[model samples]
Target: MAAKKPWRIIPRPLLETILNNHAQHHRVPQPLLLHGPRGVGKTTLILQRLLPDWNKGPHLTGYVDFAELMKGNLGTSPGPWASWSTCPQPRLSDCRKILEHCVESMVEKGVSAGTITSQQIFTTLNKWHGLTAALRHVLQSKSRASDRASPAALWERAVFAMSRECTTAEVGRILGFGENEKNGLSFEEASYMKESVAALKLAKKIIALQQGWRANAITHMNRTGLFSRTLTHSCTDWPCLLLEFLSQAAEIDHFQPKLVINNIEVLKHATVNSESTVSGPLYHDSLIWRIIALGANERCLPVILVTSDSYYSYEAFLEFGYMEIFISREVSVEGLLG
Candidate 1:
């Protein structure tokens, strides 16, 4: 082998295209799809190059790897509905799982990876102190739960460590929040931690209602069906609370938001029908970016570049005669409409 290069190759054209699009587009920039052979440094280029540049810009940035999301179990097993063997439907539960996993990935990797530290994001949340009520509940619940060493547990610990304020009072004591990890977070780190913890807090709430996490909450929320639909985005145009958190954080920072979603191919495993009929020219991924992008203008949203990469990029390009794929997303929000 030639001298093993421990570095990544940035495709200059691709980088320039992404940069120009971000610079030019405002108010709901569409999704850009990347296509190439496997192991061709696509994901590497995104993490090593694209994310660094975006994080440095005036926008907030986050990276979600679908394959990694699929691998993590967020305090629950893959139920029959989500079991990969069944090729389950594209349910909100899967989306909820994804949102949860996305938070985990950001919180765990963001500081080290330096993808979520927008100067504006840091400025917006710098003065936030005290244990937010939602964070208190999440930490208290984790403190009370069994199996204190799972990945979920470790993630909770890490979040607690990152988010500790000056006073390690009652709630902080529950998770040892302010014991040893104070006086170290920079303004950027503090801002990212505030938003990330808030995102995680909201993700937990969504999961509670959407899934059977708390039977009583479901019992009451599902009884009305209206409350259920509102929480789960069944009848609402708003996307997941986590997505909202991302947008709101970026908006507060006054920077446009950019989300790099890798491996759309992994979503094939989570489709509604087990048939080979799902993947085609028209299958707009309704789960994640599509919902956020569609209502961008009406929502008074900043220009959020929600880019994903899959083989569909090439197929859509070939069919639509476009070099890069920027298409709308279509998802069903049918229930609780009454």
Candidate 2:
């Protein structure tokens, strides 16, 4: 066969790291960044090169074409959920589609691999009991509430169902949940708690993801995310759980896992909603926060965030504005020839 043309446009070392097993297995990548002008072959390299090889290599990739995700799910211009608030209170509406995509990707990988069993996956998720309860409570509460209820009404129910004061105040106090016996919850605490509670659930399929007829609840369900209530194990969020699942699945073949976010620019593509006017938190919930919390803070999963925008640096993040942080490792896709 003729020599591949991508070899000419891509750097040798980066290409080797992507395609080689020894390099990928040992190297703990810190959210690998590919930033350049729109036509510099970044997406070309991802779609045409790394993706093809990585699938069969000692690594698994959960690729999310976020631009398409936005258009298909939210329309060309998504409202409040698409952007972060200008003040301290972040618009967690940011994580909506991402959560769905992660679950879908997991199901796809599980079905395609056909090597691992639901029991093993269940074992993996069971370790993060808190996430399990969050999903269960979110789903159950939402199920119980009337569909005609307004968003405000639903939020009140979420606070009631998920809050310790509403569920188990004394027990929560023992678990260090309250400020003092005299007070219930400060406004800020109640807000953040409801935010976390509002973030519960990841589609009902999570309870019993099926591959086929032979793969029903009995044999192919990862019910670990629904088996508990109290936060006895690790109290993690959804992204952490998704990344954990990716790591666990890859480890089955002694490989690694990676997150490929194409067109990360879509993250900033928000149509301003009414909440943008309020005094929001200084910082916003970030895609990078999700990755770093798991990659550097917890495990060693590599993430690839591709964007053409020059300003998506250190802390600029995909959606949240202006709180730029540092990404220690970066590679500019430069010197691509005609």
Steric overlap count per candidate: 1, 9
lDDT for predicted candidate 1 compared with the true structure: 0.40
Tens digit of per-residue lDDT, candidate 2, span 238-280: 4555565555455535555566777665544433233211111
Which pairs clash inside model 1? Answer: 89-272
Can you give the TM-score per candidate against the true fold?
0.43, 0.48
- Candidate 2, residue 7: Cα displacement in angstroms equals 20
| Every candidate's lDDT | 0.40, 0.44
The parts of candidate 2 lying over 4 Å away from their true place are: 1-23, 26-29, 69-95, 111-236, 252-255, 271-284, 314-338
Q: What TM-score does candidate 1 get on C-alpha atoms?
A: 0.43
Judge candidate 2 at residue 43 and give its lDDT: 63
